[model samples]
Target: MEEESMEEEGGGGCEAMMDDQNHNNWGAGGYGRHLLGPAAAPLGNSLLRGPAAGPTADPELSDVPEANGVLRGCEPGKGGAGAIAAAININASTSKFLMNVITIEDYKSTYWPKLDSAIDQLLTQSPGDYIPISYEQIYSCVYKCVCQQHSEQMYSDLIKKITNHLERVSKELQASPPDLYIERFNVALGQYMGALQSIVPLFIYMNKFYIETKLNRDLKDDLIKLFTEHVAEKHIYNLMPLLLEAQSTPFQITPSTMANIVKGLYTLRPEWVQMAPALFSKFIPNILPPAVESELQEYAAQDQKLQRELMQNGFDRGDQSRKRAGEELTYNGSSACASSRGYR
Candidate 1:
């Protein structure tokens, strides 16, 4: 009975050992099966296929040192590392191609053609007739071109050309028939005067030397006339007191010279009539014959009355039309004055 019990215990121990071994083997086999579903199958097949047999073995499975080196390099972790590296290389190549495409699109759409066309157009139009060109047209073109080209030197040259053309045209117009030339001359004169008023103050403040040296006396006189014609009489009255003060000095102002200056200012500042009633009254008597003064007053009254009637009647006319009419009459009157002076 003792021997049988010992044998029975030995048998139980052997059975337990076998059961543990079988369990471990079964777990390992289950793990291998899971891996083989997708991951291990391909590697297993490659190993079974073996590398290559001879020199003329499949090119797809050649056995050269390089090939063996590649296989060894691609083994397990190293082989998987090669596949990852290949994927990274392909992504990098694709990213570079996309960047190149974006750069090309930007160049074609915005920068390249615009620059080329502007350069070509500027070259073509550089030498055309600039004198007959209207100020509005020239200024518009110049502004457009400068903004596009961003060329300071080119802008300066264009401005200089326009100014020089204006000067030459003004000189020519002065010698032509006064009746025919007056309207065009006035237009050009108005443009130059506006520019002078706006630009000259800045130039004087910043670079007085340029004005004194470069802006000629003729241009100065022309600008003065333009401004004087538009000044109000209130300004003239204010100016008169100052002029009287200046004249009261030891070197007295002559009546004739004062009259001429006052006449020019009167054309500019009609509002001066309200300010210096006594002075204007005294001056008018001394300057003109009584009959002529009476006639002038009558004519002025008639003009005002007519203008009021036109406005009240709803005539669609502007100040410019009125100014042009006055200018035409002045031209005619000046011709008569010249004729009378010739007789004298």
Candidate 2:
């Protein structure tokens, strides 16, 4: 009876030793399974069960306290399996976030057109005309575009739109009657700037972020530069003459109109106002009344005396007199004479 009891005790010790060895082997195989994927699963199972899974790999062995811990750890509710599921969920959430992010092209196509239309309406609409789009919608669209790295492209498009509009304004000025050119230009500039005043608030975010940060200039400065390039530069020569004419002779333009032009130029950029001295120096001679110098009576008499002698010498007196009278001899002769005189 004592031998029998000793043999049973030895068997139990061997079972415990086998369980411990299986647990250690299983722990090591867990890492291998992760590194090697499904191809290593059979190897890990053979190591966990010791060469072959048979009668010795008792299903009941999993009921042991240590085995229960390992089994429970692998269940969907806990341990590495749970961690894997959580990681998957986190990745899915991140993918969803990335999918929802707005792209620059999206803003350019969707929101930017709406903003451009509103700008056009503001620029071209008559005063007191109803504008269908609200300012808030424009602000939101601009905010979204700037937040999504669409600023530079949007700003470039804005410049093109404004420049095209100003080009049209310049053409109108070019076609205007010479006396009305300054007035038309001033009216166009006022309309453009006033429209910009209404439109600027909508792009405040872009002005603060993209324009200020990337270009080191504000939107207002960029707009002024566009005006300089497209409108002011193109018509500057003609504009300067008309402006000087207007300033000297207010009968050609209202005092208020001239004042507005001056104020608008000063407000747009101090550089523009500063250019006045240079423009005056360059253009004043063209616009100014021709200087009248009294000719010496003796020299004029000598010239007339020479002309009479030529005629007396039978140089066709009627033809000579007609030539001396300075009649326009060709269709463009009068225009050539006027051009030589000064701005008319």
Candidate 3:
């Protein structure tokens, strides 16, 4: 690569100094204390720890490494001893210090492509025929990246790429004609679930450990967010009229084989449920008979004793009248919040 070619960077900022701030003890420590001059350092951005950071990876370097795994910085012939520094500040005394510098370019062209392909295989290949031969290799590469102290950035990038892929899928799902929108979207969700089930095994470490412990999120939940936003929310919004129809198959399959898309939404956390209070409201009228609704509406406007009587006679509509009487209607999946709820 050309000089000043290091163009991107990744990794979190962590500063825990061990007495030796500027001390370069290369000889005393097994790995030489090699702090290159600022002019020639390429991977220096990641290694240098500063004050704080937000929820993203570090900024990109100006001269990132090339795809062939070639390290091009201050060459020995060009910058003399300074060139040999490349981009690392080695100072380890106890264990065998092996400074493996991985530039963002290498991650993009090398590691990410292989991982992306593996994911493609997982999501596309038939589950019966899916083979995760590269699970070990991929895990090891990620393990190396973590050991090299680049886990945060790698984790962040993985989240982004997965979200992007899910977005593409959601768009395709949305393109379905109105007549078949929910039906086709259900099929897509089934496909996505099958793909997730078939492939998640390969990345057990990433799902269980890296995602939860390091990233502070459950793997299953994080992935489900993609569908929740793209498929669930959109389907409810775009296909509300159809979904609310009494003959709508998606709503009719409630107690048994719920539409996979809706079931998928049910599997999400309470926050998602809270955000969609009105989502369940649309189907309320469809579920209950008009007579039952009228009886409940009467109780809703009457005394507590009469309301209790209506409730005991199986006409117990929780707040349905208030809901119908221009109240701040909501659906919180509770018998008390509203009997028509509990769709979960």
Candidate 4:
């Protein structure tokens, strides 16, 4: 009876040990399953294949290393580390790209002054003054300003510069002597247009993208209109009488000078010369005397005859110079020959 009781106790002990072993194996499999999803099945199967299998001697237990490697791959920081690193790198690159973008405020403070100075030089430069304008640098500034959506401000500033310059020109014209009036005014116009030839290209981006788009007007046309309003029209009453008096003086003012003034007026406002104020309409009939017209015609004929005589005189002078040059060359040659031939 004592031996049988001892055997029964041993059997119970064995059963409890098997249950504890199964429980430990289940816990490990459960941990892997929770973290690794379907991949943990092999771990569980290897550990819990049969009740009789020993903890360390099972054939399926050989696959535990591979399963552990897979678990390590799916581990929180270990498995997804490469992807996380890549994401971090992408975010850093994106931030760097955004930092390099040029903002409107930055462009205004840095690049705009270059353009303003260029315009100022153009407006204020004297005759024969050399303005050192860098086309590429100025163009880049304008391009950047336009790209940053600052084109409207650029256009407005340019218009203001031109208007102010023209106002100053008008004052100078008013102060000039009547005989020098047209000549001075024409010189001013020429300078203004010459400066614009340099300036217009720099502002072309603004003119095309902003001015034309928003205002539906051309830059050159606007400049001409401003000239008409601020200069030509403003000084018309002061300028017209002088122009007519100059036109009547045949020997004094050339026909080309009168034509240029008329053409300049027409260019400013097409109808102003002929129709708007009928510039010569009442002037010729009412203001100018008939005796002056007859005298002007006679003076014009005399002027043409004098010009022909002057041209003939110029030709005669040129012929005389050529003959003198030939004579000199012959004398020089003869002297050279005499010296070379041992003649005194």
**Top candidate when judged by TM-score against the true structure:** 4
Off by over 4 Å in 1: 1-167, 175-179, 201-344
202-315, model 2: which lDDT tens digit per residue? 788778776786679888777877787788778776776678766543245665777677666655555554456533333223333343556456556865776675566565
Regions more than 4 Å wrong, model 3: 1-103, 125-133, 198-214, 246-259, 269-344
Give the poorly placed runs of model 2, Cα more than 4 Å off: 1-100, 268-344
Over the full model, what C-alpha lDDT does candidate 4 score relative to the true structure? 0.58
User: Cα deviation of 225 in candidate 2 (Å)?
Assistant: 1.5
lDDT per residue, candidate 3, 169-213, as tens digits?
Answer: 778867777767766666667777777774456455455445666
The residue pairs that clash in candidate 4, if any, are: none
Worst-scoring 10-residue span by lDDT in model 4: 1-10
Better of 1 and 2 by lDDT: 2
Q: TM-score order of candidates, best first?
A: 4, 2, 3, 1
Question: Tens-digit lDDT track for model 1 on 153-192?
Answer: 3324334444454556555555655334323333444444
- Give candidate 4's root-mean-square deviation (CA, Å): 26.9
Evaluate residue 279 in candidate 3 and report its C-alpha lDDT on the 0 to 100 scale: 51
Instruction: For candidate 3, give the lDDT.
Output: 0.49
Tell me the RMSD of model 3 versus the true structure.
16.0
Off by over 4 Å in 4: 1-104, 125-129, 254-256, 275-344
Tell me the number of clashing residue pairs for each predicted model: 10, 0, 15, 0
Quote the positional error of residue 105 for candidate 1 in Å.
46
